[model samples]
Target: MTDSSNRRRLRVGGLPQVLLQWGFGGLAALVLFLMMLLTFVDVIGRYLLNAPVTGSFEIIELMVAALVFCALPLVTAREEHVTVDLFSHLLSARTEQTRAVVVGLLNAIILTAMAV
Candidate 1:
């Protein structure tokens, strides 16, 4: 690829980028690990002690939300998320740009609504 093309690529280079990736990825990993541990303890409590962890479901739910949020930064930085390119093959270059903007706006709106 040309220099311009390389420049246009994701700006995920250098030490800061590495730190950003590690920070978010580590946070997500920690959350996942904690969730697993919680499940293990909950199971032990249920069988061995005949008592389950109180509010385990609520804790898991909150952890899941945290897991998703923590993963978002890493996903956006790496652009590793899945894409719907099925429609891209059918559109022209100019139309593709417009479609991308419209879809991005729609996505932002939907995500905002969901966040609220």
Candidate 2:
């Protein structure tokens, strides 16, 4: 294949992928850390200072939802979901590939249905 054709098949280079991955991953991590920190502060404030952080529960609830939903698309893109593979280990490579494709198709259909 020509160099140009090879280049066409290639995606963003290593540096870009690293940057993008870390950028999103860091955002997710920061949200989680902030959530924990706020909860801790609120607890301490209520018990020790006799003044709770106002709307702490509401903030936590919203943060939790945002964290999960925001992470969902990234996790799907990263292919990071759990799998139960009682039979998969026994399958040949081609069989495994076919199984994966089928699973992906089903997931796509389910996502589409959910969207509707």
What are the per-residue Cα lDDT tens digits for candidate 1 across 1-116?
35564345535386777777778889999999999999999999999999999999999999999998888757655545588687789899999999878866776687677678
Supply candidate 1's per-residue lDDT for 108: 66
Best TM-score among the predictions, by candidate number: 1
Candidate 2 global CA lDDT score = 0.76
- TM-scores of the models, in the order given: 0.74, 0.67
TM-score of model 2 (CA atoms): 0.67
Candidate number achieving the greatest lDDT relative to the actual structure: 1
> What value of lDDT does candidate 1 attain over all alpha carbons?
0.81
Q: What lDDT score goes with residue 103 in model 2?
A: 79
